[model samples]
Target: MSLSPRFYDLLMKGSFFFVGGLAGSMYATHHHHDNLKILKQDLNILHPPTREFGHAEEKVEVSKDLAVRDVLKYGNPGPIADALARKAYVAAYDRRLRHSAWTAEHLTAASIARPPTTDTSGPVDRGKSKFIEDEDLPIPFRARLADYFKSGYDRGHMVPAADAKSSQEAMDETFLLSNIAPQVGDGFNRHYWAYLEDWCRRLTGNFADVYVFTVPLYLPRLGTDWEMACVIGSPPNVSVVLASKPSSPLTPDVLELSAGAFVLPNAAIPDTAPMESFVMPIEAVEHAAGIQLFSKAVKAAAKPICATTKCELIIRKFDDAQKKPNLRRAVSGLV
Candidate 1:
């Protein structure tokens, strides 16, 4: 189905953030009582002074001390994300969701190239890679192999395995549960999503540097109250943004950046569906996912990626080319 007019309008506005390089490094620390007091002060700005008609306004200070102190007595219950760096990509894993909040990868001709035969290790092989839990994460917060067992979803890679063809270790890193989410197997992940991924990789040919961010989003349905659903799995929607710097310089010292954002449902999509139909505003994606993807200056200066290059997806009959494997049998061994 096509997106609503409102979504189309947002796309036309033509401004969105493209986090210049990779996501910033994040550090975790123990929360102290002093920090809680500072947080209370910052939160108090939400309180507005009360006033009556035609009377002097009364200034009231809301005492947030008790609430803040009680809430943080144990420590800040955070919406915490674990920053992870792999051989091929960088990602932030959401502990609550048990999947990556987003993954960033820098793709260049050399980065995605197959390894030389002279290397000690053989070229990266997808057949040899296995889906494994990220041991770096706490056991309680990791996405378990059992979660997708008979769950009717694919253990989809946020950073495509093909993007990490440079090394066997890099390809294996993409199989980590932290970099995966529940995706519809047939028409979506195996078909259309794969096509979109190939398109991003192809950008390396035209641009000197290609950066892609994969984000899992939960957008509300239009014209209805936003209802939350609890599923056996994690995030339901995916948004991917591709930003590229042109190979040739526009000026001796400058190279222009161009980017495009696309959001797709975690369901089967028809091959006939135009890739352009999924075009989304970068602002819309940032607001929906609660993450700033780019700075104002970068957004203002970036040219619409589709304008600089063709945004069409090449149809590859992946399903026809390969037989569907039984999800249960495949993952049962991993357990």
Candidate 2:
């Protein structure tokens, strides 16, 4: 066959172009793969593959075996300006209320292991520690032991004495008037309140550490005169009671720092009362207290596992939680 000169020339050029293109593609592919491998190595150093997406793998080292002390975090929520009674437990005393706004403690099985230093019912030996005025307070507003005498209210403790069982100094610190409140005598303080305290100590059985916030809530109350009052202190100051008839039109939500007691058990309470009954959301407390209880650091350190109301554990017997025959309505006329 006779080939045209133009056709031959075009064929030779096309062949040369194909060979050059092929060589260029092979070199580019090799270089691209090398660059990709280097990029992958850099990525691996920055972030290795985790077990799952949106998850991170980290290695944390600890110097000592984990203790309850190592787990719990501390915070005080109050007039950040107020003096703090930093003892075995901590309290923020409100001189205006003449009571602690809140008392907090970190409890553990080991922390509460020791027997109570003093008899639970017996008289406190002043030699050990006495309920004296909190010199910590300013003079005019200080609460004194004399104020509680014959006041028809027990010098109630926000932080129970039993929680301070580990040491005499700790137990004694609990007796300070700063930590005391005018709690109702036999029914609430000595009975139901005591029961709650016992339940708190019992929690050590389940959790390594329990962070507790013992708060005093002065909610609205019905007075002897059938008047509504927000009781603030032990001795009801009649002047502070706002005279508003029930029939009157409401303007704003009226809340009295009158009376309510809350016990927030962190872990599963003994299969008794519905755990939901005891577990309270921090927001509820913050609303009632008009103060933020948990700070950012506290929230970050160990978020409360039972902050939500979802509960499945029934730990205590219902009937057993009933008030005793002799138990008077201690919170009566108060809440």
Candidate 3:
């Protein structure tokens, strides 16, 4: 097909974008047709940089094998990301999500394996997950989640303990730290976790139809780092996935609505919008933590955390490159 140079340029750019994950890496190893297509299309161009696609294929070492690391960052980042998808809280290993593709190279090259996490009833001993004793913010209030820090809230994860023994090797991908987010017990155990489990199976069974790999869509704001840990696979689903059950309130979605705990559903989505996917409802979150959210803004769709279920989302970075502040709303600028 004949096309304008500009249009052809867009096709090349789009192709570069399309081959973004482990699949792309696989292409590097095996797909001569794709390679030749790129070459034939670009042969007439003035000059092809030493690196054609900028940073898509840079090599890096991770703690384990290079092959494993590449799969983690690129090939499987999407599956893990999908498994980790939840409405609230800043999860552990979240920092990795915002890294640029260049970051993948660093990880792959390092081949440094990530330490595993466990469900310690007490604070983690250094190498485990983070629990910085800031002494400033009322971790007490957050840890216990009582009356203090009325406005402050916790972001707990639907999947807890970060235990890889949770599921089968194929399914264990969901246990990656990338798949976790701050969540409340009532919300998660009762509804969110189950929903996530169901979601995970669906992805495994039917997601190949929609597999576009990704890089960190945005830079961490203020240079804050997001963390991640490797979740090795196990037989049968992880014990954690099975243990993830949310107990219903005396009634479903009916918790003691606190001044802050509330749920306000968004208006019927616009017709022009793409498919809409939302996390659990505010009622579910409220029911889990025994509190309400956004009481002041009862009309808004946002919810709040309970005092006892204390969790918090660490805002890592912002995409300040954009001229205007409000427009940069995505976690990753491109995402």
Local distance difference test values of all predictions, in order: 0.63, 0.45, 0.23
| C-alpha lDDT of residue 167 in model 3 | 24
| Native-referenced Cα lDDT, model 1 | 0.63
Once superposed on the true structure, which residue ranges of model 2 sit more than 4 Å away at CA? Answer: 1-81, 115-127, 220-279, 295-335
Tens digits of lDDT, candidate 3, 1-335: 12224323322332121011111122222332332234223221312334233331245664687777766765553322112222211232222322112101101111112235547433323234342222222232222222213412122222333222222331233323343222222222223233323323322221111111111111011112434222211000111100011134455443222112111011111111111112123332322222222232432422222222222111112247554433211121111
Q: lDDT of model 2 at residue 223? A: 47
TM-score of each: 0.71, 0.49, 0.20
Q: Against the true structure, whose lDDT is highest?
A: 1
User: How many pairs of residues collide in model 1?
Assistant: 2
Task: For candidate 2, give the lDDT.
Answer: 0.45
Give the candidates in order of lDDT, highest first. 1, 2, 3
lDDT of candidate 2 over 1-335, digit per residue (tens) = 12134322322221100000000133333432342233233223223454222312233565455563365435323343355655468777777777776677777788877654455544333357668777777777778878887776678777778887666677888888888876544323554445556655665665545656666643343345967545334321000000111222373343211111233211111212322233333433444454555544444444344331122221222345575343222111111
Worst 10 residues of 1 by lDDT: 20-29
What is candidate 1's lDDT per residue for 218-262, written digit by digit as tens?
A: 433222254432222234344455565644555534767897777
Model 2 worst lDDT run, 10 consecutive residues: 14-23
